[model samples]
Target: MKRQFKKHFSHNSELKCFFYRLHFHYDFYKKWGSTTPISLSFWVFTFHVRENICNLTLKGSVTVKIISVTRIIDDMGRIVLPSNARKALNLEEDYLIMRIDNKKHHIKFSSSGRGKEVPIDESGRIPISPDYMNKLGWETGTEIGLFMQGEEGVLQGNAPSCVICGSNQALLLVKKTHVCEDCIHTGTEASAEKWSAVLNDLFQEYKQYCEAAVTFTNTEDVHKARTKGRRLRTLIQFIGIKKEHPLYKCLKEAHDILGKVREDDVFIDAFDKEAENNQYSELYRKFIQKAEEEREEHRNELKQKLPHIIDDEFSARWKTFSQDELKDCVYKLDIETALQKYEKEFSERVIKYQKIKDKKSDKGLDSLHSVRKKAKKLRYIYNFLDLVQSIDYSRKSRQYKKIQKDYGDIIDLRDWINETGSLGEDIQDDHDDVKKVRKQLNQRLKRLVKQVEL
Candidate 1:
């Protein structure tokens, strides 16, 4: 494969560029399945049909190889791009990529939406975003006709659209398209003020959740408060806020503190219901009481978070996020475009979950739990795009929800059993209780797998 790859560049002057990166890990890359790195286009060039490797420059538009190169991060977290590759790729001394603002464009392509700003170095070569190009089905050796737009080196609103998506928002035009940041980049960027207001309100509510920690009357409020705390934490992360700052740590600690309370509450609810009308209600009464006691003990643990959550410093930091201005509202992604970009992710997750379904072992169950959480994220993006209204959405939703519910039940029962052991109150015949629940869980999971038909 090295000889094969080397031969392609053997006669080309750019052989030095190709050999430096690929030779470093030739065997590893050959084993790659669906997962590709940042530089998808160049590898894609290598993957293209030889017969289709031709480019027709529109006027002066020159297409070029936008190969992806992954740099290893040292222990100190620094990446060094080699000089030969940089020169060959026309990279700048200090590369800067300011995110593209979709709101600035008067006429926006609502279909494709927004994406990341293409990084332009001090040197003039623009790194092509392969997302749309791949969508356009271009090969690696495709020639990109390079052209300058506007006068005085100031690219005007007439900046070339992405070579792929045709979005004129930022400088993503490798002569035309912006580099793809993943399927999530495109979508809404309506008004910065509204985003700020919404974030402010959410942050305020998060603070309220912390304030009401002691007053929460039931598991529902506790669940919602925990969910809100997590959502607030993720909102800033999605917006690329100052991540390492104390504010992120506060949000993380707040959610983590609530996480225990929520987990215990879920176990209590699951067990209490199972025991409610059972013939052995009398026998299970003590177990229910034990569960409730455990939940309360964890709830009291929230007191530890009060000082940090209630402090003005923490409140002020969150308020700063609310003040951020996002001109565009990135709420919708192009469904077809997104599917093309994320199909590999969507496929591999399903495959992974399938491989773990029958393994009732502890480690397997832990992995299954992680997969369910990830499935929820996939569902979120699909629904956010309103892909739910599509023809097959209902079936797809059904298959995953069934799988998630089964795993949820198994996890709940497992946690309940674990919690029983830790509650310090001896429940007689605990083995019988766990065995009964495990048998039922196994039966339900089998049925769910059949229904999913995967």
Candidate 2:
């Protein structure tokens, strides 16, 4: 009845005032006067614009028209409320932002406007216009709500207040959200001490390997030493130790020389195995002989190089280093933030590979080699930061590792194609087999390349 009388004032577009118009029994409307209008008392509604009908309840419903309002700011910089709006809202001279409920979605507005409009610039000068603040009842020291719903934010309800003071400066986030610098987050001594122990252990292992690698007589023994040097180099990079620190360049050079022997040793063994199994063994036998000669030369060079790398620069400088440098090595960033930063670096390799692929240039195959190397480094970077064992990568790490292996798989497939393709006319019986194997390898390689998508 109240709404039936209120229908005349409903959907007033001129004043941008929308109403929930309802019609009821004639006797009810007769009792209540025109000024006291009965309207739908709905706090919230899900309006589907496509449907004209209002789905009010699961039961039978009344006609409830929802009209959209468009308000204009008057030239005097004031919103003039029409008679219906003033009546509906019970208007007074002053209102609080917390009292108004437009009821679309929730947005948090705090006193200091944290995660809202910043008032000052880098020079500590106020950037907002004073007149604009005055228009919104915002004085210099007065606490106000600035509700924003746009591109930069889609925050709902309320966020946690500042972790230290329980103030609503719940803006800055690190390991935990709402932990402001004025309170909870600090450059931790406990964290630094923990990482120091990890660094000390790594430094000691690297020193032992540098000492022991020279005495190694076999491939497997040397490989162990090489792996130690590599993990140490990677650890230094992971912790972002200063490059200008004297050991950086010298240690990297030493690792490179150690890696050279491993690759040659791998190929020599592959050739010898090929010689033993091939139907036409004479050709592969000659290949194995040549490769054997190269391996001998590599071994001779490594024997001299490993000792010089250890004695000259690495051990001497490393021994004199203070524990303070290692203690200062851990990143201040929380584990989650640090992982995200590292992952961004890891994803950049995919971006680089994608650029090469998209170009459809002849050099795509050659460029993939560098991407493969970077993939391997990124895949193992987490292993180097073993101190942060609490961070779990159980699910995502498999996919991360699979990508690395996929890149390496292409490398292996290409080699197989090349080897089988080079068997020449003298090896007649193996010619057909070689051709078939090459075709298979080439096709498999093509399929594998297609799978390497970012």
Candidate 3:
């Protein structure tokens, strides 16, 4: 049997006999999205009104006391506000503002009448939209001609010099849009003349990922790895290479390395938990021993061929850029020079597998597999070209779409695998479904790799 209740929730103000209780917490505002239309306007008014009253009474001897109130919700979830608070706060029945910070886990109430109206240009930069600016008959290069003060104090809405760069000129109306010349000029030019910006941005992003990855390794930190992944994607996006390009193909390999490391870490953790819980801990121990041994075997193979890997590809990149050319960038200048030296070591993993792609030696093949896995860290850096150059948040972009398709499900499965490892082998029966899901995920991975390969 299915039952559904149709509850009505409208942006309505009803005349109430009691005052609603409100709480304020700063931490909520410090964090993520608490800025819904219902939330934003209410908070803005609540903050301003509180500040307004405080300022207005500051000069005088009068100390205004705003009463704290609470509404008690019964077991049935019905809230009754205290009658006294309603009368004290001048409660009138009109559509008023209610602020909710679900993130901070608090709620507040305010009357819309508390907000003072300030003049704004229709375009909305002066807190008015561009259409409104046109409606208001604002001309291009409008002078600093407006000012306003609420009970709190003065809040002049006048446009100032550009914020990004120090230019005394105000934003002008150009092509029915208000934008400063500095802001316009600061944007990346699409022309061939400014292509160096793209190249510089690519190298800088690559440096950032390398630094972050190194930091992750040193700290054994999950957060640093996540940051490294994000920056690596950004760098890959900036390079904007086709999937078929040799550089991008190499990047795909780098992606697999991080993916494998993350996957293996999760699997091992789960294996460790099973060992701890089961009476037959030997099985768990054996599983971990096998996994570790496999990892070591892979590592050894990479180490053996690493010298050649470094020498082959990295030397080419180094020679393409002079010592001075590499040294001048901010990312290059900030990170230790050893990161550059280490690239030679890591590239060996990437290049060695490519060299022996057809080798019949099973040991060589298996060893090469792990090296290829580690190579993904490099691809993660390389793939950022698409992210930084082409991805646009305002519109549907191909890079974002591909991420939703390629990485989204894999990340979920990876997290699940990590958590399952914590439960140990004693709970293996409980994780039959998880194991099935992982099998499905492996199939997905095969498809994703094939699509990129094609």
Candidate 4:
């Protein structure tokens, strides 16, 4: 009977008969006699029947070497390899090499002379060490499909999940790990806390700078204080503080006062450098003395007002606002929406400036200055978002920074020309040197205007 069966049964027909017999617990001929089809676990029964039939027909001959098993990853991220599988594969080495197939969503383990060694314990358990687990982004309680192919064991993760929260919904692959949007929101909350810390630190530094400016006679101190004040004000606006807020008003007043002193210092420095040339020596000296006197007057005004601007009451208000109001605002802020709003504002400003530039009117210098200020604010906001939200806007930030610098140079040249004109009337020598410098500045300004794009 066995010989007749082996001789007459086609390979596929014999397998079908074998499957029916296994599913119905009947002899192959009897099961084949019935026409009813029986369904079973396809993969499990197919592989099992193939292995059994091969062993029976071939008398323990090897046709195909394979094994399949399902294993649960324990808390320690360890899985037991059955003795039969290990023996069949001749997996006697203490270590195996692991390879990941991200495309197929499976991992393969084999014996190798190279690569990192994954250890198998004495009880036939393979412990996926911490490093390997992290590399695979697998966590405890993950089910893995284990199967053998030739001398290699393959593992497949059962389902994708959020690495942070184990959520299966809305999973996003990030650097070989899955993340869900809910966890991303939680991350944003954590970032808000970090931003609060950063804000507090900045406020403290600004106070320190204000103190240094008032206590010291150095012009650099005033410059540092004003810069810090501008940064704080930018942050304040980003946090959605109204301009009518006392905090904004206070900072703006102080910033404006310091700007006067800083401007005089800049003028004096320019004059000193120009005075090195004997042609403008007397005129430069006179202007330098006048700038020094004005700077002292502004400095005294700043010293009187600085202590009042960021006093204890203001500090208390800031702490209250940052902890209570600012925290909530920042946490609830949709970063995408904020970015869009700023971008829209910037686009509008660019359009306005472009129209003004096209008209070639001096009346638009104020509009040009507005565009420059808007670009600077946008650049600062981009940097702020990067630090607080981990968004990569560095390219946009760099772009806007260049815009700010270019416009700033034009404004500075314009101011210098105006100042030179004012001072040149007092110099009697036909004003040739002044005209030459002014002409050079005007030419450079025109070139810069031409190079600038909307």
> Which model scores highest in TM-score?
4
lDDT of 3 at 202: 46
RMSD of model 3, in Å? Answer: 24.2
Model 2 TM-score (2 dp)? 0.50
**Relative to the unseen true structure, what is the C-alpha lDDT of residue 375 in candidate 3, on a scale of 0 to 100?**
40
Q: Which of candidates 2 and 4 is the stronger one according to TM-score?
A: 4
- For candidate 4, lDDT tens digit of each residue in 248-328? 998999899888888877788876887897565776686677567767898889889879887998899898887777756
Question: Which pairs, if any, clash in model 4?
Answer: none
User: Highest lDDT: which candidate?
Assistant: 4
- In every candidate, how many clashes are there? 26, 2, 38, 0
**What's the TM-score of every candidate structure?**
0.50, 0.50, 0.29, 0.56
Alpha carbon lDDT at 407, candidate 1: 62
lDDT of 2 by residue, 1-454 (tens): 3453244334333111222321222342243324343222210000110011111111122221111122233333222323332233332323312211235343322222233343322222222334444444433344322212111221223334533344544233322223233332122333344455565677777666656655546666556667676666666666565667667776777777766666556655665676677664565565455555655676677778767766745665765443456434443223444567767766675577677743223366556766666555555566544333333444455555676676776776665455445433444565665565556657878887887665
8 Cα displacement, candidate 2 (Å): 62
Candidate 1 lDDT score at position 126? 41
User: Residue-wise lDDT of candidate 1 within 285-340, one digit each (tens)?
Assistant: 66667767766777677766655665798867655544432332123212344454
What clash count does candidate 3 reach? 38
